[model samples]
Target chain A: MRSRTEKTLIYALLIAGTVTFLFPLWWMVAVSLKTPEAAQAATVRGGIASLVPTDPQWHNYPDALMQMGSVRWTGFLDALANSVVVTILATAGTALSSSLVGMAFARMRFRGSRPMFLVMLGTMMLPAQVTMIPLFILFRNLGWIDTFLPLVVPAFFGNAFFIFMYRQFIAQIPEALLEAARLDGQGWFGIWWRVILPLTRPVTAITAVFTFIFTWNDFLAPLIYLQSDDQATLSVALNSFRNQYGGITKVNLLMAASLTTMVPCILLFLAAQKQFIEGLGKGAVKG
Target chain B: MATIELNCVSKTYTGDVRAVREATLAFRDGEFIVLVGPSGCGKSTLLRMIAGLEAISGGTVAIGGRVVNELPPKDRDVAMVFQNYALYPHMTVEKNMAFGLLRRRKHGGISGLLFHRAERRAELAAIDRKVLDTARTLGIEPLLARLPRALSGGQRQRVALGRALVREPQVFLFDEPLSNLDARLRIEMRAEIRELHRRTKASMVYVTHDQEEAMTLADRMVVMKFGVVQQFGTPGECYARPANRFVAGFVGTPVMNFIEGRVDGGAFVAADMRVTLPAARWPRMPAGPATLGVRPDQLRVLYRADAGASSTAADGASVAATVRSIERLGDRMDVAVMIGGTRMTARIENDDRLVEGGSVLVHIGLGAAHLFASGEDGARLGDAHDAG
Candidate 1:
């Protein structure tokens, strides 16, 4: 009986916490449906009235899309397309390159492998901002500025954090399995492709989802490298939209555009939530 | 079908960790040889060297008369079943068994590409047939479609065995394959493995720490310690005539007992006990300190009064002892007896209801005694046939 009451109390607390966390999201959607005048007027009422608009203006979506006029290619749709392409390619490159490097580090024995892996992990500790200016100069010298190359090409080399995650997951596989595969006539690459890859689906999903989200939301690199409107990603394009229309009358359009930019990330998290939590929890615990 | 020869093979890790010393061994064609030892004794390391999973540091390993030290595992044409039954977790039993054949190439380059589709299909069908036949032999036909995680320990072990058998390689190496099974299942699988060896007549090398498994399954047993082969012979020969004191103690259940003593005037003497040695039987007997080894089953325990009369009348040696403990094992009783501050176990028929602290006499079977030199190595002194 005591346990039952405790369970009820815990569930009640969890529900209240969920409401507290989700209230802002609910308010964002509600305000996006309100006209600019109504949104401004509702803010005076405070609390619940401030959250829910008196009249829902569904036309605000198209109006917001149009008000942010298309540059040569900086229109909302084109920017969304650029984000999707960059994210998909970068995510694929990161997963493939990171898992391969991680497998070599985890399973192979070589003269300098231990020191090399340690150096690779050390890179994760250095702040990305430390390398920002040098990287910009290097890409500029390579004639890769104002192109997607600066944003996507580096992922093919590998990411230290994702490589570390893959190494942790791959190292847990039984050595006997590798030996068995060897006896069954598999070479190193064959074992990696067939045996190691299939078993590491959870870690791969986690890496891919994380890379997608990171690349999709990354504004700083795109802002620095992409000078033309045609190459601007969603994050940079959205910021440009805000700068162009900073008046009080355009607040509803801003809210609508912000909500549009966040939908893909939210859907991705929902789709792969279980794998994400499992991969992160297991990697830390095992390491 | 193949003879495996290891010519002074050795394995040394970095930091000078010698896992296997210069070990020379030869396994005959179609023979079942078991490498039995305690943990860290290099039995598994030796097997891996033969399977090409481990590098041979000092010597050459030849399978079917070809030196395999430089060859990769696939080119070596050997299969190994690991202790954990390392089945591919993602594949079904059928695919697991057929994996090796699918990966192998029958022809190379342009010729291979010309007939690739037809040859590949034929190879797949042949692999399926071989896998099905092996699964049938192991009685796992119904489980061919299921993954390894769904199977029980015994079933998984059978599938692992089938995986090795499906390849039909020249040599089969098993590294403690049944160590993970329950007691009853271990015994059951032991018989199946021996039967499989008999049917296949393939040269097999098995490694285990279980002496019973070694004794029952091996045509010849290699007893090792500290990366060195102490003795290699038939199980009966090793049991009857161990090369050193280590083998004598390692290869038996209810281990052999040792008593330190000195030889004086053609008689062995300890603290308060003496046994007259027959001069005619042991002609080269040196007069010095020695160790006497006796199996538990060779010592007969009798009641105090009967022991007193038998000692005076008997032609064998007998010692007065007090029973320290009595363990009734259904058909047999193992009685721990103390003789002159030394403890020794005597296996007797359970018909006698002996109790703890009871007075008894332990008769040493004169012909069953083993004499070892009283030194650090404790080398055997007489021919094993003399023990009879």
Candidate 2:
């Protein structure tokens, strides 16, 4: 009974700590909606701040949306579209390619397969900053600058960390399924496609969610490759809005755009929560 | 059906751990052969080699008159049932059974033609019918709509069997398929598999460490140890006359007892006891101590008072033993007797009237006794040598 109470207390303390850590993000959203007057008033009042505006200025949203360009809402729409395309393509590419390659690394037999897998694993420790200049040069040569291709095409091959994660997930599958497939006239490719691919759904869903969120929220990659304002993702576009609007920024519109950017990922999580939790459990148990 | 011939087949790992030594055996078409051994004895490895799941490191594996060492498992035309019953968890039983045929049809049955939906669907439907029929045969029809996770272990095992039977392959390989079941389920499944084999008339190669399963199911048994074939013959041949000490010690329940003694004037003598042997049909005596083997059922227990005083003459064949304990197993009783400071068990039919620490007379069946040469190599020294 004492240990149970202790456990409950530990869980409560952990939830308190998590809320504490999340306060900054909550404060950012809360403060973004307030006018300068309201924000200062809330700060002066100290505990229990209000997110709503007493004198609501709904025009601040359109003003913030148009601040980066002559047109009012086109900039937000274009940036949103660019972010969606890059995220979808990158997530799909990473999930498909990395999973296939990871299955091979986990189960298949061939000369130098181990060494190749090791090399991929070795890349995980490498600092991306070291390769940024070379990647930029290569993209320039390929005429991929100012395009989303530079940001998404590399995912088709796979990231080392994702490949490692996929390989770990695939390794937990029993070898009996593969053998059973073989007896059923299934060749190597057949076993992979029919047996392994179907069994890895949880891991695939988890990988897709993480990939989508990561690519959607990334700022550095877009800032480097996307040279044109029209090609800018939401992050870069948000920066451009802040630059144009100056000190009296339309905080309400910025919060609306941020909230808009976050909604898809949140919806994805809600839709796949069961599989995502199962994937996390599977991964934990495997290691 | 196919005849599998393993010629000098061996498998050695990189660290010189020999999983299978130069083991040679042959399986006749439609025969049920069992590879029985202790744990880590490489019985499963030999079966995998026949199924082309394991590579033959030394010799050739010929199946149906073709050398299959170069062939992959898919092309080997043999099916295997694993101990774990590796059903695809995501697939329903029906879909799992049809997956193989659908794949084969998609690949033009390995000719690599363009995928045709019509032909694939027809093949899958045919396979589904066969799977459903086999599931019914295995008494698992109710589980066809369920995923593997929803089925019990026994039901999952039947699904695995159904999947294998749907292929109608030439050879069936079983790798300790009943080891995972409870005692009752194991017995039930064993009987079902035996019946299935009799009906299908397919050549089967079963691997297991359970002696009872091997004895009951195998037409011929191959006893293995340390990756070497210790003995190979009919179960009766193995039980009645073992090739060596290992086979004799390994194949029986409660095991045959071995006692050290020396032959003296056609009678084996140990300490204060001596028993006459069937000396006329045996090998020339080796000039050293020898070991005597007697099965528990072959040893008879008699109380000292039960044997009349007149029978205690100078025959030298009777021994005085102290009864250590009596185990009444409902239909039979196993009495443990301490003879010359060594415990020997005698299995009797409902002889529960014996008491512990009481003196008794143990009579050895002279004709049923087995003698082995007492050397570093314990070879059976009897007429069975000629049989071997």
Candidate 3:
């Protein structure tokens, strides 16, 4: 009797929490389908009406894509393409280089290897802002300023955190496997390619997903490096969209654009959700 | 097949931690040598050094009369079967066996790329044939398409063995390859490995802590302790004439028993009784405290009409002991007897109806007895054969 009441109360609290967390996403979607005036009016309703607009403004998506006048070339499509190219290249570079560097650190036995790994780990502790100025100067001297090189080239060098994560994952692989490969006449590079890479698919997926999300959502680097409207990524273009149209009338288009920008990340997470969770769990335990 | 020779090989980890001490040994062509010892005895380390899987800190390891201390494991012309089998989980059994062959060729950069695809395909087909042939030989042809995780422990072990065998290397190194299998499977695999060795005639070094396995499989056995080689000899020689107390205790099933006593007036004097030394041993026997080592089978147990009669015998050759326990092992029984303050086991025929707490006359086979100097390092003074 009393347990029944307690269960009811617990379920009620859970439902309330779920609604509270999901309300923003629900409102964003609903408002994206509303006209500017209706969205502004729905926000005043403060309840169900705000979460579900009465008459959906389906033209807001097409309008946001075409009417974002500050964008160059084919407007939002060009920005999306730019974002895709940069994110894919940068993510690929990060995944490949991080895994190779990680395998070397975890398996190779060279003098100063330990200290060098420690230094690499120490770089993770240092904030990206600390190296931001120096990196800018270096890129500028290389004549790579106002180009995608500044955003994508650094990824090829490897990320300290991802390398550390990959190293931990690779370290958990039995040393016997490496020894077996060596006895099978595989050099270090061959072992890394043929043996280690195939076995680390889950970890590579985790790295790729995280790198894709990071590069896709990153606004600061794109803001600094991408100067022309033509080279601007979706993130930079979206930020510029907010700045250029900071009026109440353009709110619906902004919400629609934001929703469009987040769909790929959301879809990717959902697609690789199983591997992502498994990789995270494995990393937490082994690392 | 090749003769592998290790000359004063040693392994010292960072901070001067010695895993394998300066040890010298050699494996002749087509010989099955087993390195048997307890864990941390450096047997595995020694085998790895020979395989070129480990860096030799000091001396040289020569394979096929060529020094390979600086060579990588791939270049050493040797294959190793690890304790855990170490099968590539991502690969099927056929691919696992063919992997070594595929990587054996060294292709140069640009010029290699031109003809690489055609050559690689031909080589791969040849490797596949070799893999299938080896699989057929091991009776694992059906399992060739299966991944390692899908196979049973024994099947995986067979695949691991197949992988090593497919290489046809100069030497084969097995580091406790059967340690993971069940008792029955281990026994079956033992015979399989021995038969394989006979057929291939490849020089092999097998490592295991199981003395029984070592005794049955080895043409010659190395008994080690504390990273040192205590004895290296044939099984019969090691069991009959051990180099030290350690070797004697390590090589046998029911361990050799050691009783502390003093050598006085051509007799071994203990607190409870005295043992008369054989006439031949007395000439060389030094007058000092010593340990009398005897195997369970070497001690003779005699039924006594009166329990106290042997205890008070004038000659004092036999000791009176009370039967503490009996482990009946089919045709034989291990009878634990309490002789004075010391407890020793005696292996006798199960025909006798011996009960606990019953007194008996225990005679030490002096002709087969082993004597060692009584100290921390119990160096062997003489063996039973010394009597002659």
**Models sorted by DockQ, best on top:** 3, 2, 1
Give candidate 1's TM-score.
0.91
Residue B213 error, candidate 1, Å? 0.7
Write candidate 1's Cα lDDT for A201-272 as tens digits: 888888889899999999898899988776778887766545545744566777787788888998998998
Best by DockQ: 3
Candidate 2 lDDT over residue span B24-119, tens digit each? 888899999999999999999999989888888999999998999999888888888999987888889888776665655653553443456566
Q: Which stretches of candidate 3 lie over 4 Å from their true place?
A: A1-11, A36-50, A68-73, A109-118, A240-249, A283-287, B106-116, B280-283, B310-317, B382-388
The digit string of per-residue lDDT tens for model 1 on B28-77 reads 99999999999999999999999999888899999999999999998899
What is the clash count of model 3?
A: 0
- lDDT string for model 2 (A148-228, tens) is 989999999997887888888788888877788787777777777777777788878888999998998999999999988
Ten contiguous residues minimizing lDDT sum, candidate 2 chain B = B307-316
Model 1, position A71, has a per-residue lDDT of 56
Clashing pairs for predicted structure model 2, backbone only: none
Task: Report the Cα lDDT for candidate 3.
Answer: 0.85
TM-score of chain A of each: 0.88, 0.85, 0.89
